[model samples]
Target chain A: MNRDTVIPPLNAIFQDVFDDPSLEVSDDMTAPDVEGWDSLSHVNLIVAVEKEFKIRLTTAEVRGLSNVGDFIALISRKAT
Target chain B: MIAQKTASLDYGRLVRESRKLRPDGAHQNIRVAILSDAASQQFVPLLKTLFHENCVNAEIYEGAFDAIELEALNPASGLYEFLPGVIVLANCTQALRSRYYEHKGDDFLETASQRVQRIWDALQRHSSARVIQCNYPLPYERQFGNYDLKVPQSLYSVTAELNSRIALYARQRSNALVCDVEAIASYLGRKHWFDERLWAFSKAFCHLDHLPYLAQSLVEMVLSSMGRVVKCVILDLDNTLWGGVVGDDGPLGIAIGPHGDGEAFYHFQQYILSLKKRGILLAVCSKNNRETAIQPFLENPDMVLKYEDITVFVANWENKAGNIRAIRDTLEIGLDSMVFLDDNPFERNLVRELLPGVIVPELPEDPADYVRAICELNLFETSSFSLEDTARSELYRQEAGRRELQTSFTSIDEYLQSLEMKIEVARFDPAAVPRIAQLIQRSNQFNLTTHRYNEAECETMMRDEANYLPLYARLSDRFGDHGLISVVILNVSAAEMEIRDWLMSCRVLARGVEQYLMTRVVAVALEKGVSRISGHYIPTAKNAMVKDFFAQFGFEKVLETDGGSRWHLDPTAYRPPTIYITEKQRTS
Candidate 1:
């Protein structure tokens, strides 16, 4: 799976987590961009993302992610 | 072997359903406040959905994460102002462990117990809400491994002691209850229950998948506290009560006993009998010939539930949904109080569509799984039980016989007189507090004020007789004893008495028990030099039968609100109604 394929589903998961349908995820978009994307809900988003992609990301990998692009890149790498 | 738990709502489904909750649909309203020393945002939605499914609209208040003490201890906190009927306090092992290990405290167990008790005491002082405290889950880290159980100061040993202390404390306090988080986790596999990943990420105590189960347990507690429990179990014959259709397979052919497939039905009957013993009325509504249905109960030596066990048995060609309605009318219970179980999908769907209030549980394909399926649902959740429960079936059976006998008389008055009813009215006794509290909790339909009280609260009222007049009445006739069936609590001031609570069992309705009690209460008031006696008739969806209760006995309506109407009577002008009954009391 490429970054393009992962972005749409990942966006849907993000929308569900923040309960905001209008939320759009891009490469530069970070936690601050979303209204409810705080430290408390960040891990829920991560778990939801992991469940969605059927891949388990290491703790270090989750902490290393800077933005949506990093998350998508890691997902694409792990999916292969 | 222990039965496998029924499938729980997945995280996604729970979220979707929670979002769809609306205030307009619920038949009842309850306020709940969930306070936890862990992230609690997720529990709010889960509880909302669960209670909504139970036809109870819940308004939930979630405390800030890791702020249980702050929310509970502060009188000015929003939790107190919410004035919740039920308050749930859940603390995770992770937080307690951090507190214990970080401080190197040897008195961790004692301190933890004190902290939990302190919160309970504060809540009691600040609010009248019933408290449900969740016990700590056993920590996953087995640092001391096998030696942990032997060491008193080990984390495992300390946590275990803390859990027991919490339970013991809740047992002593009438308003406090402990929810065993460890038990729930043990049943669901501790590894699956406590997701370290979720804990690391968001400080969540349990996995999101288990939220629905936890929420279900909490909602059940609330419903039982509110007296919204399932009171009757309605069963079907043919393939349901036994393995084969009784009409096709003769009495000897039906599989029910110690043999192969018969054992399943036998076990099912045993389970139903246990529920019957707990005072849950059992009824049989089936689509079969009366003889064929009656044959199994008479001939089959292996049958666990005999003919006498059933309160109402209707085996006919009529539609089951209509039969269930007849049962509800005859039993004088709400449709929500009955649970219908049938093997056929058609019958289940029909009852579900026609009588939506009736809880029609879907039967499993395998007969062996029947008992497990229903037990897992926790359809009948009760907080208190008494000797009266054991004899409940006999009372209902006698009532049925009385109903049959009533047809012989031309008038209702003559029928009531022929029954030869006698009542024993007395003040609240220490020994009968449990039954009185149970009556207060369970009496919904015939209740005037619908005021719920537990044993401890009832004891308090008994002690404070100067201000509270707590009276109870027991009924018996030529047939059998009805046990203690009515409760009335009056608030007495300098010159007036107000009825705080008035509820009676539906079994004694129209038996002139109400009129007798009212006369006795007025007599007591007049003896105390009270000028007037006032009473309330608060209306609920189930208590419509008692709407005109106060008016029927000559109490004039003084004030009417959206909730209910108030009625008052001048003791000087009151006259007791003439009825054929004898009254007795115990001086001690």
Candidate 2:
């Protein structure tokens, strides 16, 4: 695994996603923390994670993933 | 002879270890947005399990269709709030179809292809993500079919036509894949899909169990086939025992074999056997006394599958996952190679949570359907079955003997020497061109550099250039002769000798064939006075297994382009990995 790959899902999500490419990260952050992080963006992040893992996530799990850590735990759970 | 490895693997159940998912399931985030109705909430869990269950970092946002926030998806701006691999529009009615259909033009398949392409191209430009477009499900046939008159197409046909277009579109491109929602809905028998007990149906618009399962299945199949090969099918016995336990019921009493109730279970076993015949390995992981489970073979007259049929078995209940892991080891295959099918929902869920790579087929209430659904479910992948598929099961049985054959040896070299492996390196001849061409296209894992060629193409390339010299290597050892194990396409020009295509079958890897082939390249180049010999590495999702190939051969890196990596080997300084026996002839 590359060291650069260990970047938290959200930070990577933000950099790969958001228009505010200058987006920096802190764990305390939420989607609400950034601009343009609406419902579609939320789903877009889910798609990004699916692309990243080559695995699928359900809408409920996507909806239930509350924080960056929660998402991290969820993603790490599926990582081979 | 010990030389040939004839063990065949099911392309499915071949476990894929988590790597940086540049292509398949990536380790990063998959931007996903679901556009559906509040009605879809019930089915979301199943969808998530299907699509997101194994994915580590996916963020899915769902809302009423109007809530999609399409403004954020402008690709021309080259700016996006998110990048989604797949964007699904569900719970859509015919009215939505009209709008989508209006934009569709000319080749209906092309229309769907371009729509997906535009979305993928747009998403890819901004962030590395793909797209999946789901065709709206058909309304109940009773209602939708009655309205069509002039066009004479049923609503179901319309849905199918649309979905077919999408499937074709995705099939044509690597960057995008289509999600067949219409087909999924159709698979559910008419009454079952419209108003199931799990769903809370509104009089206005009917729906069935959760949308998540559908979404999840779509995502999972798409990702698995993106490159991962599912190689094996690991199954269990007990209450998963044909509706009766084998140990308790005894072989005769067990709910299996050609009879009512029993026939359902027996047919299920037969279905599994059919898969095995097609090269999907069938292994048993049960909790019966080893001898008792083994007895079914000898005593049970009605049984269609025998002890020899299965590749691996773990009868102890010591955690199904542990047994599954053991099976993976025994086969020298990967966890992804197996899909665990136990009638017990708990065991299924447990394995799903623990070893996520092992696909756990959903246990439906009816046992009769299990056998058939598994046979028909093409979701995970589609592949061209080769002639090798017919003999795969027996091939693995022989491989097991090879393993037992290993225990008798003390040292690795002794084991190799005992096999007395012999290799024949012959100049390419007209008679072998067809098979050689097939080898170039089919060879994957053991390939040092995978360069694909067709029979006619190989023939043309060979005759066209004095620079092109191709050779195929055939090997025979203790086990048997592996027809032709390797092929090399060389460009022998005076200025620069190049290795255009160099590939070897995975069966012969770790056997020092790379050294033999490289030495041939060096010797030929040296004689030609082509001071420089070069090779290239084209990065494919599966071929990443060979990135450091030339480096291992001591080739100096010359250039790295987005196309692939290039390397140079000085004709003067090169040594081959030679120890095995060899026979060679050079054609003028």
Candidate 3:
């Protein structure tokens, strides 16, 4: 449930949804920072992260998510 | 040693598998467009994974969310330019309910049907894409409760009526198809199927957990439209059709009955029997002593399937892959049409490697879950069924007997004449239009032009005899009836007639049926005072067997190209092969 464990799998999900293998999840990376990550595909990314972490994200939580760092912190807090 | 995991594949598993789907090793290149009123972002990756499993390279187009009408109605939309082979419209109940609330009177169902019809009409005008419309699911409300069933104007009643209207419209329109998403929601319990939270937040109508199953149903529709249907199922004897090894268990010892572990095998056999009844040919490819394997089917009192049910039974000590190749040759069907089921992973893998086209699904470790595992695969997706399909196994079994009887004759002509072959040739009957269209889609090896038509297109040609001559042929011999096995679409003109498409079943090959068809063609030309009869040989991967088909009946190749070649013959010089077969025609 640390940043290292959560970020790698989150980056993998981002890579798959965007179809980019080299896509990396930095702390400040937002939706516009990643190619092919539009509003339509945003739900796919959230559901994938929820699936990987074995947690559920509310609609408010998904809308509130701004960056990869915020997503990692939420996962860490939800995991503990 | 039964595995805990059966066919209930969760959403997480599908997503995990979808992420690993890379562009590699796919043979077919297909473009599919998804137009939806709900969140359809998951369909691309989900369908890509499913298509990748089938070795199809799919370029899936996801339209803007809630833009089904926008993309479908506009002639200049990207969907038209994409020219997808298949377009899936996933209209959710959430959006439909909003529209229903605004509509007045019992015209809601009619208006909804017309809206879908407009999309089909626009697509038909602009592109050749087939439409698959998903019906709305039942809404969760109990205001009227049981009274809603009796009320004709209730929203629930209107939705049910709308589904039936759309189904009826799709049946009339060849290029239109309907996917019963409501059935999927009902099958997977309502509690698990619909997630109100997801719908409220993301506008995802169906729950993400049930999306994979919906994706599976959509995949079946897409594959069937492309004529990628599984025709035959090859079953293993020991540990597959029964609980214990039949070789050691004997007929009495085998576990196949109404109790204990035997019930599992009995249920599996019953499922297989259902498939056979619906025209799927059954065959056995097992490594066992011939009599030992045959004894169980013969003497087992609790056996759900008898020995006569199988079209081709190959039971020996030979390797299953080699035996499967023999079965493919004997049945004369594409390897892709055969599905091999064995309990052992080694045998399944061997066939998978040797015959990549053959569908070899990995069974669960336990015998009790065979039916569930196979049902999940959806091996058979037929568009039409008739009396001919019900007797398909019997016809194939009798054809095998004919093949055996031919070896005793001194010449092929003598064997064919002694069989007393009769062919019923008709222009086109309204009742047989569905079967004719299905034959056009399924026939590959003996197809001359490889032009596939849907029922609507077939019916159009059937109605217009002045310009188009559509003929269907049904063959029967001393053995049994073969039903409608041949179709020819001819473009007629004042001076000449051209064969637009000619296809026949591979089972009736070398039977002089094609030659008899030439006689009919020549007769038509003579009656109409046409100078020439033209034919074309379009080359495909599987249709090379018929490259010289037109030439065999004295038609000369006039135009040749890399794509195909055209053949023509003078009507006076046409010579039909001498075969002792009688022809029946529809008399007005």
Candidate 4:
């Protein structure tokens, strides 16, 4: 599947993570803006993000990223 | 739900990067001011250890003795200034337990308590500040003698005992809680409690060195238990537990076949059962049809808890929170106690906002994390756990006794006799130490003060003449022996007595043990020629069970301080409930 296939999965992840509907999302939205992007929470979030994109984020990469956009870049970089 | 949202956020990111557009104001941060006179050496480690960017974006306001002396913090005189989310009486530990002080026992404890109270009361008066009272941590082995040197510990040891007295005193103030820092510190080994790398101590246990995890954990404890009870624990089925949807795959086709995926789910199920066993009622709110959702319990023999194990079942087409509200109404408990756990993120979040008090723990992708998160919740930690804990599930299972409340035998008196309920109200003696100790640690939800005393401390309080005196009201209703279900600690000051702490177990809450203990305590107060009897209601996450306690006793509201609601009663005006039977005897 092309990168377009990733959109459906990413949409599902965003819907699940933020619990928002009829909404707008940008590649740059990060953990800082996310209401529940907590560390205890981040552990599972990253795991879900990785499994959905069919890619991986290093532990440091996962810890260092501050926003949602960073997650998208990391996923695209790894997936390609 | 998540897989879709993850795509939405990520897609927005791609457009912004390619289009070179950066969005503004994605996350706004809040600052939490941590006030204390603790030296940077002591406080900095705490800051570093608990420095969470997401949960609490905070600033540390390190105050000196002059800060405490400010017009803002002076309770006796100053306008009760607003307080922060967490106001830890941290430096008080050092001042009270200082090696140089050569103070007498009773006076020292009372004075320290008032001093700490002034700080807590002043801060609490502001309304926003949630106070955290910690007992002074004394390195006993280093001070008493060597690591191995043990002594015949005095009844109320200066450092530790004074801290405990302060803890009890703090409990007398509303919405103030005493974190058992002393007991936690006492258990810490050199490297276990403190982090050598960070050179910091865990606030979970106050040691010289600190770990960062302790900070987040402490914040969780402070926020979660402010003034609510976790009423119910709603659960999910299918992949959430045994790996496959029973409808799609059939009962035998499910992944819960013992050793592999089944083991993890089995352990998770058992863990949830244990929480239910502790009086946290269990309810099932699933999307599946009632018959299909319940079929697993009837057909699958490996299931740990059957359909009857659940207190409420809503398997129809309804919003998760709606189902939860119904469960709350049926159980007659609060939505706060309800902890909704579902593998689906959409369902968990729906309940979170609609019913905020209901703790909705995110079900991890892997069953292992799911199990870990449920058990390791420090907010659910009971300071005391005894025989009552393991037996709590059976007690609820047998709560068929509540049905008996409607129809009376003849009169109100006959109704009581029909349901053979036996209550053992005893003066705490050495014989009941084991059970009493457990009650002090595990009984959190209904505890008036939420204070924990070890066996040594419990024994010492009873033995002392000029200090604390404790009494336990144990109830054995028709179901079974509730074992030391209620506790009342009385602080004897000169000729007057104050009920320092009073609470009853949730299981036997409506049975009138408070009346039983109140009458007995008043009698003792009268016998001792105590001028006036008084008690205070200090609020906590779980102790809201006794919010209107003093008013219920007909005690006149004498002095309502920033600390808590206070009431006073002359022996003549006092009248406790006259019901069931009267049996009072002393055990020394």
| Candidate maximizing lDDT | 1
Off by over 4 Å in 3: A1-37, A65-73, B1-26, B62-64, B74-77, B101-110, B121-127, B141-158, B196-202, B205-210, B243-253, B257-261, B296-301, B405-478, B481-588
lDDT by residue (B448-484, candidate 4, tens digit) is 6677888998898878757777888766655456667
Q: Write down the RMSD of all candidates, one decimal each.
A: 8.6, 15.4, 8.7, 17.3
Question: How much lDDT does each candidate structure score?
Answer: 0.83, 0.61, 0.83, 0.59
Clashes of each: 0, 73, 0, 53
Chain A TM-score values for every predicted structure, listed in order = 0.93, 0.75, 0.90, 0.68
* Local accuracy of candidate 3 as per-residue lDDT tens digits, A1-80: 78877777887888876778898888888888887777656766777777788898777787788888888898877864
Compose the digit string of candidate 2's lDDT tens values, residues B456-527. Answer: 888886686665787778876666666788888887655898888778878766666777767877888888
lDDT score of model 4?
Answer: 0.59
Candidates 3 and 4, the one with greater TM-score: 3
Model 1 lDDT, residue B441, Cα: 93
Ranking by TM-score: 1, 3, 2, 4
Residue pairs with backbone overlap in model 1: none
Judge the docking of candidate 4 as incorrect, acceptable, medium or high.
Answer: incorrect
Label model 2 with its docking quality class: incorrect
What is the TM-score of each predicted model, taking all chains together? 0.75, 0.53, 0.69, 0.39
Q: What would you estimate as the lDDT of candidate 2?
A: 0.61
Candidate 4: list runs displaced more than 4 Å: A1-80, B1-216, B222-226, B353-357, B374-588
Deviation of model 3 at A26, angstroms: 6.0
C-alpha RMSD between model 3 and the true structure: 8.7
Docking class of 3: acceptable
What fnat does each of the candidate structures reach? Answer: 0.43, 0.00, 0.29, 0.00
Error of 2 at B249 (Å): 8.9
Give the candidates in order of DockQ, highest first: 1, 3, 4, 2
